[model samples]
Target: EETHPVIIAGFGHFGNTVGRFLRANGVNATYLDIDSDRVALLRRMGFKVYYGDASRHDLLRAAGAAHAKLLVIAIDNVEKRLEMIETAKKHFPNLHLYVRSRNRFDAYELLNAGMLHVYRESLDTSLRMGVDVLKMLGHDAYHATRMSKMFLKYDEKNLKKLAAIEDREAYILEARTRMEELERILQEDTNNRLMLQVDAAWDDASLIKEATQQATAQTE
Candidate 1:
């Protein structure tokens, strides 16, 4: 079998973007898809995509899963995605799995199953839309951007905490408490005059760093 640094299981819109970005950056990846039509279309566009069910152990082995450093699971079907995760974890223990989750619940399932890297498909885009809505409502661009960064950081951290709770009623209670805490913290930040004194341009890295630090300090 041929060896590759990465193996992507699906070639849909989400997986396509990932594949394109990796290829553009000089990274070689083995692509697999269950849709023959989609695979043909991608092949016509100069992409080397294999047609097969990625959840199958033999297909993954043939696609170089043994030596691949990362496995990007961007498949659409939830059941199939979970099946593929199980298959990968069972046979390719050395491969790091980067999973695409449909929502928070999906992420929780993946987390419970020991998947470390789970990207919720709509989280970042939804936050971006919120930032734009705030800007259109006469809020300062930098402030809106910073608020969104903080929200993202808080929600992600909260996701992990909520995921660990197995009891349904307990999870609901904790979730409500977390939501109230988030509102109180955001309100406090809004009232802080010192936080509004910054007049710098939008820097994503700095905003994310500040948000992470702020979240860490609050939890301490």
Candidate 2:
């Protein structure tokens, strides 16, 4: 068995990106996947992927779970992902877990299970799209970016609150209330021109400089 600093289960699209970024930064991770075809393909492509179910205790131990500092759960199946979390926690109590959640509902289960590092797979991408739409509608690039950041912060905070409610009807009602509150707060911010203020890190001068350079290049 080889020792790895990071053990990533599920070498699919989500896990692949995480593994790639870590590899690019000079970090080596042990990758595990249930899909034999994908595992073989990745091996041919130079990725060190082991074919096995990560939810299994034996496979985790073989992957150096006892010594690995972090375990990333990026599997697509919700039930299997939760099972992996349980197995890892029971066997390697000290290993940090980074989980990939399908959505807010999936996130609630992970949160309820006491997992701290949960990544909602599509939240960031969806927010990025919202920012792009704002920019396309002639909003300031910096302002749009700031709004997205604010929205993410608000949504994350609200997710935790909503996750605690067990009743479906109660959850739906609270979710609706939160959505309305978010809309009102954003409206208030717009009316107050809070988002219009320039951020020093992304000031208008830099944007103007970039635009001027583009225009200059076009005429040349």
Candidate 3:
């Protein structure tokens, strides 16, 4: 039986990236996308993508959702995204779901719907940009990166905590308090010099050598 353990539902920006990363790691996944134009384009480019609405149970089943181990939901439409989740739950209860959210509010909706693996499309990239800005402003790279990680951790936790609060005013107050707390934590960690050492392991020479050797191996 031909079985693809991972089934990706969408082939747009985020879905393509997830598929590329998995393929690079030697993992094969079946892709289903709603856009016929995209499916035709990708097929000509050597990708095996099926054209179908992933929210339909019959289409999902035909795409191997029943036997797939992981169902990746990267559909950009909010309603279709939720419908896909519902369809997957109803038709393939055993499949693990990984979702991509448009923003924090979308994340809250997904979280409340019991999805544990939801990634915000812009959050990580924006945080990395902020880290770069900090480095450009004369902060240590390691320190800036560490601060971004800290904020990421805290913000994720805060999102989950804030999701349950019903009162908007109370939630705003709590969020402000948490923001202040995060700043204080970052300040303390920085003052204590909690940073990785800039040693040989972190040196550009070592990194360049490793990349060169990898490229050489691939060409051979």
RMSD of each: 11.5, 8.7, 11.9
lDDT per residue as tens, model 3, 89-130: 988998999999999888989999999998999999999999
Per-model tally of clashing residue pairs = 0, 0, 0
Q: Given candidate 2, what's the lDDT at residue 128? A: 94
Number of the top lDDT candidate:
2
lDDT of 2: 0.92
1-220, model 1: which lDDT tens digit per residue? 6688999999999999999999999998999999999999999999989999999999999998988899999999999999999999999998999999999999999999998899999999999999999999998899788888888889888899999999999999999999888877777887774444542333665888899999999999
Better of 1 and 2 by lDDT: 2
- Sorted by lDDT (best first), the order is 2, 1, 3
> After superposing candidate 2, which stretches have Cα over 4 Å from the reference?
194-220
- Report how far residue 140 has shifted in candidate 1, in Å: 1.2
Which residue pairs come into collision in candidate 2? none
Task: State the TM-score for model 2.
Answer: 0.85
Off by over 4 Å in 3: 194-220
Q: What's the true lDDT of residue 44 in model 2?
A: 95
List the candidate 1 regions with Cα displacement exceeding 4 Å: 193-220
